[model samples]
Target: MHKRVTFDNKLLPYLLVSPQILVTLVFFFIPAGEAVVYSVFSQDAFGIEINFVGLDNFLFLLNDPHYLRSFGITVFYSVAVAVSALIPALILAVLADGVAKGATVYKTLLIWPYAVAPAVAGVLWVFMFNPAVGIVAQWLRAAGIDWNYKLDGDQAMALVIFAAAWKQISYNFLFFLAGLQAIPKSLIEAAAIDGAGPMRRFFTIILPLLSPTTFFLAVVNMVYAFFDTFGVIHAVTLGGPAGATNILVYKVFNDGFIGLDLGSSSAQSVILLLIVVVLTVVQFRYVERKVQY
Candidate 1:
């Protein structure tokens, strides 16, 4: 049975949580409220005049072909990043779990990439893939492949996806490794005694036990790909090569600051928030059913 401890001073509970509540109010709720208010109003780029234009901004976005294209691009990019990050991390975690010696050193080296800032990671990739002087670019040229991402839309999108996924792989590796380590050795030994091969034991037992961790990582990676990848894209592609890598979050910044379309940018933010909320709800509602714990 679970035991509950009651506080003698009821106000103490509220006081204990007050700091986090204040932070949420200051950072999240306040900005969200401002966005909702601004989204319904039209404002000049100079901010000299403002006029109420309820739903006009959202309507314009709904009808804009560029916005529609961006919506599709963002979905594809997010999926690619999540999949690419998760697969390699899982493989690395599995390999590291089997190491009998130097495991700590291997894990430490694998996790060090997570400490790198997203922009710095992007810059690192950019240097390696730079068309003029990059080592990888030179290798591609030697292989008779055109390696310029500056002018190629598809190449630019692929490059940003690689940069973003590379940054996230270390984060996923930590969780996957933890989950792998938590599984019981008895279960694997029992399966082996029952004539189960390594591959069969992994597929039937280990993978099933990892469902919960996999589900959690899926949600986190999706959110990260959607929102946290802005710095990487900014540093690397700047959402260019004909706007191929222009995801929603970056578009919000570009529209608001560079284009100076406050109303539209606010509306886009609201919409992006809604999309993430809905996706999270869907995952919790449906995807969680498959998780073991």
Candidate 2:
């Protein structure tokens, strides 16, 4: 019985993690391997050709204007959303930590938008931006503001980026709140004793201590803006108005599913995967070096 119990204890960790491992293999690793295999070969709707084209797809992507534009647009969108979301999340977290009155109420109100599905949020934003029926649009019209997302490219991009950033604010806040809470009050008290001002204590002690959490949230927010905002774009913009809001993921969807150009789309996906993996690895490495614990 002792030996059996020992065997079960040894196997317990693996048993607990097996479902996650299997899901990763099935959904991520396997599909990524197959995508690499499929990227080297061109196939039509009927799936006839099996010829090895080597790096032809990649070379073609390098020369393709639309692919280049899509890559640039994706970078711009990712940066825009990250900066916009990070600033507000950081400020809100600090305020929530300091405030004595109705902190829970403020947190609950701030996090409410996170409960709304991305697709639903996109639809709601679109409804609000509608020219005729939207309350926002009506207010804009009454104020003599000419806000049109359909024809104008810059305005359209701004609207999409704002919506995407709005969706992520709550997630960022949650991570930041956890980080703030994890910080020991003793440290702050010591800083106060040493004549450190609020701003000084925050920049010198709190910031470095919060490095791990900030790194975590940054990677998460970047990846979310990169891969998961497709539903919002689909519901709101559909990459419309002269392809202004078409980021890489949406471009991949349009190419692979809508246009049936799987080879090019797979190549694009591989590039995206490489970018994300490199960034994530760098983040982990940087955090491991900086984190106190």
Candidate 3:
């Protein structure tokens, strides 16, 4: 049974949450409001002339083939990163859980990448795959494969996806390891005594219990791929091989800052926010039904 603590002083409760409220207002609501306003208006790069454009920016985006291509690219990139990150992390967690020796050391090594900045991770991957001097590139070339992300759009997209997935693996591993450890050993032992094999116990007993953690990670990884992968894209591909890796967040930055299309950029940001919000809502609505807890 959980006890519900009642606050006698109403003002104190409000004060306790005031800081968070203030932060949300300042950082989230304020910027979102600004984006909404800017999205509806067109302004010169210098801010000297402002004009009301209404829905022209959004309509332009809808008609623009490049923008549509970017939308498709973002969906594919997010799914690839989430799946790649989740599967390897789950495998590593299961393996680590079965280890009888040096478990802490193995877990520590797996987690070290999570501490590295996304940009640094991207740089590391970029160096390993660089066409001129990269070791992996040399190996690929030796294997009769032309390895140049700089010149190939599909190759550039794949490289960024790998980098992003690699960066997120450690985070997913931590959660999965924790979830695995929390599962009762008695259940596994009972199943084994009943003549269940390792694979059967895992799929029927362990995997079902880990569903909640998996679901949570799915949402987090999707959000990370949508928004937090900006650094990886920026450092690795810069949305190139002709904008092949231009996911929505990076597109917002590129359009707003580089292209000097503030209205279009703001519209893109609004649309991106809507996308993430909708994705999150859909996950919680439909996916949570599968979670045991």
Candidate 4:
């Protein structure tokens, strides 16, 4: 039998929890409700007119080629950001875990990047890759390669992907380092005594033990790529160079805020919310099967 904590005063429990409940209702549910309402109604830029259009906003999005393109770009961008962030961070974490001298300093330096804001990270990269004055771009031009992200769609996409991934790497690194440290030293030593090499031991033991952390980070990284990188894209490219880097989140901003298509933007946002929900559910349902503890 499970024992439940009893509250002497009935009102006390509700009072204790009231603030959080009120905050959630006001910020989350209320905004979500407003977005849903706005999605079904067409509104002019000045908000002088808001006509109920039923599902027309959503239908327009379905028929819009730019919206379709943004959807595809979002998938690719999310995958690339997740993979790039996870793998390099894992490698750095593993190396840092094995470090004995200056370990604290090493980890501190690695974690510093996470403290930088996404917009700031974008600006930093933009300066480094600016075709006219950037050091990296100048070097590329010297080597006979065109390095103008402002003019080249592929280059613009690449720049944003790398910037976003770089920003997330420190976060993934922290989690991975913790996960690495949690593995039992005895298990690793036993594996070594059994004639397992470092690579073999990692693949056979460490990787399996780290699966749970890996799965959690994967879900978080996907969500980050979907929503949190908006600042990066906005600051760096503004989804420019022929909309090459216009992932779904940025597209919503571009359409709603920049293009002043309020109804269409709201529809896009609702769709994005649904996509995130579905992706999270799928991750828990299928991906969690691989998680080991």
Candidate 5:
């Protein structure tokens, strides 16, 4: 039987949790409610006028070529970011886990990037890959490659994807390392005693144990790529080289803040919110089933 904490006073428990409830109300529900409200109405370029157009904004978005393109790009971008971040992180975590000495140092160095803001990380990468003065850019050019993300749309997408993925690596690495460390050493030893080599032991034992961590990271990384990389894309590509990097979130920003299309932006936000919710629910309902305890 599980032990349950007994509260001295029911009122005391409510008082302690009230603050968190208030914060959620203020920050999440309020904004989400406002987005839903705004999405149904049309406002002139000037914010003075408002008219309820009912599903018109959403309908407009559904028919918009640019919005469709952005949605497609976002799908591709999220997948790329999640895969790129997770694979490299898992590799690094495996390598670091095997280090008998200086393990802490390696882990610390790998995790340092997680502390940096997405925007700051993007700027750092842009400078390092700037076609004119960036060292890597110069090296690439010297190797007879015409490398310039500023003018090449595909290159710009690749750059933003790389920057987003790189920033997320530290976060993924921390979780992957923790998961790797938590696997019981006895299980591995038993497998080894049965003539299992490193690769065989890892594939048969370690990988199955890691499924839970991988699934969790998949959900988190999807969300990160969908929303949190806004700063990185803003600073690095600004959805450009011809709007080629205009993922849905960035498009929402552009339409709402820059283009001053409040209704459309709000509608997009609602759609994105729904997409995330559905994806998370699907993951929990289906993907979680495959995760090993």
Candidate 6:
């Protein structure tokens, strides 16, 4: 009985973890498997006929001009948002780190936006950009800038990109702040004693130390920009004027749910998943080569 009791105590942790393991296998793996299975198949009008058509959907998407356009737009959006968000976030993080007073207040104000839902953020931005009554629209017109998203594809893309980037600043800032806080003050002091200017110290010392955090945020923000901003695109642009805002995930939503072309949508989703996986791999590989600590 003593031995049995000891064995049960040792096995309890595994038992506790089993539920999560079971749930993941059932919910995540099963659906992913189904998606892969369906991607190779074709569905007819009745929606009941799922015939295995082996790469037909993939080939069709490859040849489709609209898919090509959306793919380009998606990549552009992700890169633009990543670059725009990273710079400002780094600046804010540094500023927060240097503040001698009210740092908490500044940090709180900066981080507040992260709490807002992307759909809500999109709605707020759209209201601010409203041509008739939006404060931003009024300011733009007064400044002699033509900024109507309804008529201009460039303006539409910019609006969506800005909105997406704006919400992301808070998330990036949080990571950056943590990274900045983690850096040893002794290193900064050493750099200062060695006659390193603030900019030089940042570029050479601080940036290198922060590379791991930056890399993490890069991958995370890229994934969010690609997959999670569906709410923003849906609420704000709905893939907008002449399919200009039709990004990959939005395209997936449009095709899979709205257009009810499940097989093609699954194919598109599979492609998007592959792109994300590839990007994640590249980031890890690049970081492994350069990250010192």
Candidate 5 ranges with C-alpha deviation above 4 Å: 1-4
Q: What lDDT is obtained when candidate 5 is compared to the true structure?
A: 0.93
Off by over 4 Å in 4: 1-9
**Which pairs clash in model 5?**
none
**Residue 68 CA error for candidate 4 (Å)?**
0.8
Estimate, for each residue in 1-293, the C-alpha lDDT of model 4 and write its tens digit.
Answer: 99998879989989999999999999888987888999999999999988999999999889989889888999999999999999999999999999999999999999999999999999999899999989999999999998889989999989999999998999999999999999999999999999999999999999999999998899899999999999999989999889899999998888888899989888988998899789888888988986789
Question: TM-score of model 5 relative to the true fold?
Answer: 0.95
User: Least accurate stretch of 10 residues (summed lDDT) in model 5?
Assistant: 5-14
Pairs in clash, predicted candidate 3? none
Residue 291, candidate 3: alpha-carbon lDDT? 82
Rank list by TM-score: 1, 3, 5, 4, 6, 2
Which tens-of-lDDT digit does each residue in 1-293 have in candidate 6? 35453454878899999999999999878887877888999896467777989999899999999999998899899998888888899999899999999989999999999998999999999899977788999999999998788878888889888888889999999999999889999999999999999999999999999988888888888888998899889888899889888899999899888988888988988897788788878878876678766
CA lDDT, candidate 4, residue 92: 98
Pairs clashing in candidate 4? Answer: none
Evaluated at residue 240, the lDDT of candidate 2 is: 74
Model 2 RMSD in Å is: 3.5
Better candidate by TM-score, 3 or 6 = 3
Collision pairs in model 1: none
For each candidate in the order shown, give its overall lDDT on alpha carbons: 0.93, 0.86, 0.94, 0.93, 0.93, 0.88
lDDT score for candidate 4 against the true structure: 0.93
Residue-by-residue lDDT tens digits, candidate 3, 230-260: 8999988999989889898999999999999
Give candidate 4's TM-score.
Answer: 0.95
* Candidate 5 local lDDT, 53-75, one digit each (tens): 99999999899898898888999
**What are the clashing pairs of model 6?**
none
| Model 5 residue 43 lDDT score | 96
- What is the alpha-carbon lDDT for the whole of candidate 1? 0.93
